[model samples]
Target: MAFQSKQSMTEPRDRTGAVQGIEGVLLANRDRIVRFLEVRGAGDGAEDLFQDLWMRLTDRRSGPIADPLPYIMRAANNLMLDRYRSARQRELRDKAWGEASATHAPSSETSLISREQLALVETAIAATGERPARIFRCFRVDGLSQRDIASKMGVSLSTVEADLRKVYAALAVIRRQFDAS
Candidate 1:
């Protein structure tokens, strides 16, 4: 809890005689912080989140924090929560965007995909196999959540996720072929 001298105040928390910027403390604990983030559900984004944390700390006036490491870590956790909320909202918006305008007819303006593109997409989806195609339809066309689709299809959640991945891989191949021509 002791304050370091102004000269080295920007250094890592462990150095007793001096204090440094929050950035220094964060840099010193980079591995630990990123590991914490990974364990906290950041997955592959932990490193990116660490960089973002640095940027967030950049403009703030350097002040003597009694526990700089934990303070910054708490900030990272908040960032993750904010990210999760933003992604959830975006998914909700996308789902709502796919809903019927009226009479179950797709809105042309909303879904501007050409008939040719739709045919390509449908063919690619069907090529994945019956289960994957069904899963794709249940999730995308039926607008059911993966969990709901799994329950309805009598499959495990992981099975649903696996089928969706297969379907997406086929769709990716279609996209590449389409882009080439």
Candidate 2:
């Protein structure tokens, strides 16, 4: 029998019976995998998932899988699910922490300083002018977006942005004076 090439024997083969490295197979199918992930609701995270797949494939040593496409797709799906679960857990943990912290009252000195700071901020916003003060209240107190403020006030978006900027500048000056004192 003729001597078989060592390279041919050692190289991984796909379901098609063609010899290819796992990396080569994965690289060739990268675009298809990303598209699959996007369809599965990964959106802009498709590329990131693909990179994770690449790392997983490269990091492990295993025998040639008869069909890697399905395997890869499964891995991507699992990774996406893991990320979603992790994000949900993190959000819950943060909410719980925030609630815990909110229950604690500040020290008397801290409360007094906070009240004084609020008074200074209010004074600074009032000094800026009526339009700026209203815009500042709409944003900071009402938590309205700039676009909402502009639309509600029948002003250009730029006007709203400018008002906010003026308010912010005045506040910065007040803050600097307070820090100096």
Candidate 3:
């Protein structure tokens, strides 16, 4: 007789497999998620929120999520709200007094670079041709995947991807120019 462990069934399909799957999902959606937050002034913590969302998704405490996409958006939004509250406090301090009185410290150079990268992304998004720009905004800014964007726009996923490629190419050009300058 073969013995099967009870824990095996609920163990994330396989530890490495789950991690890989989650990583892939994050990579596929990360740029768009960060860009979405960036345009909304949450750019400073976009990557952090992205990481946090992935963490929440992978957390055993939450158990299995029925729908990961909606869950991710909700998590992202909540994290963004928390970040906004903290930022607002800093802003108030800076406004009432000055940088000297500000208790909240600024983040590191890497974080600043991330924000700059997001800015370049936005510039590129804006520069894209009309339909592409709209599609990119729907996907990147709204935190909707290509499938969701396509469905909402009444287009195909391939069309959404084509739009993204154009936007990405424009962003590359913008990033290069920004780097040089």
Candidate 4:
């Protein structure tokens, strides 16, 4: 047919063996592949992944595939999965970096971990005896001055000071343990 000759003249053919069929199938299924990626949570990166698929498809030498469509589709799915894994890993790395570099604010707020810390401090302070524990609660919780705390507890100012020093020594040991862990 003269029309076949004219068509062949107008269109370029693949000089390479298997790439010709793959490129043809790729071009035909590009839209489907992109949609597939979006549905797999690729979002706006679907187009980028499609381009990646194209580059990767042509990356290695291969013989002709008996089932090019499934092969190409599987490759696209695998590419999306690879992207997901890489993004997940990046997020975890960034979170770990942020936590490691963040300033430690022990008194800022209470979370579950802070509750455990509160328990530890309570245990250490309780070990100092009832007088020191009451003194600590009055000074830190009631925001009372040391002289007022000594007056309220009917003790000398130096006794109050000594009780506070005991509390401080116990707390400093807990601080060292927290930092080491």
| lDDT for residue 3 in candidate 3, whole number 0-100 | 25
TM-score of each: 0.43, 0.42, 0.39, 0.45
Q: What is the lDDT of residue 15 in candidate 2?
A: 24
Q: Is candidate 1 or candidate 4 better by TM-score?
A: 4
Task: Report the C-alpha lDDT of model 4 over 98-128, residue by residue, as the tens digit.
Answer: 7885544223222323568789989999999
Give the per-residue Cα lDDT of candidate 2 at 160.
95
Residue 163 displacement (Å), model 1: 43
Which residue pairs clash in candidate 2?
none
Q: What is the descending TM-score order? A: 4, 1, 2, 3
Cα lDDT of model 2 by residue, 87-172, tens digit: 65565456547778765333323122356788888988999999989999999999998999999999999999999999999988
Stretches of model 4 off by over 4 angstroms after superposition = 1-15, 101-181
The most accurate candidate by lDDT is: 4
Error of 4 at 6 (Å): 36
Candidate 2 segments whose C-alpha is farther than 4 A from its true place: 1-20, 101-181
lDDT of each: 0.75, 0.74, 0.67, 0.76
**Which of the two candidates, 1 or 3, achieves a greater TM-score against the reference?**
1
Compose the digit string of candidate 1's lDDT tens values, residues 1-181: 1442353356444533223447688878889999988988999989998888888766544445666777787888888887776765555456556774344343334333457898989988988899999999999898899999999999999999999999998888887775455
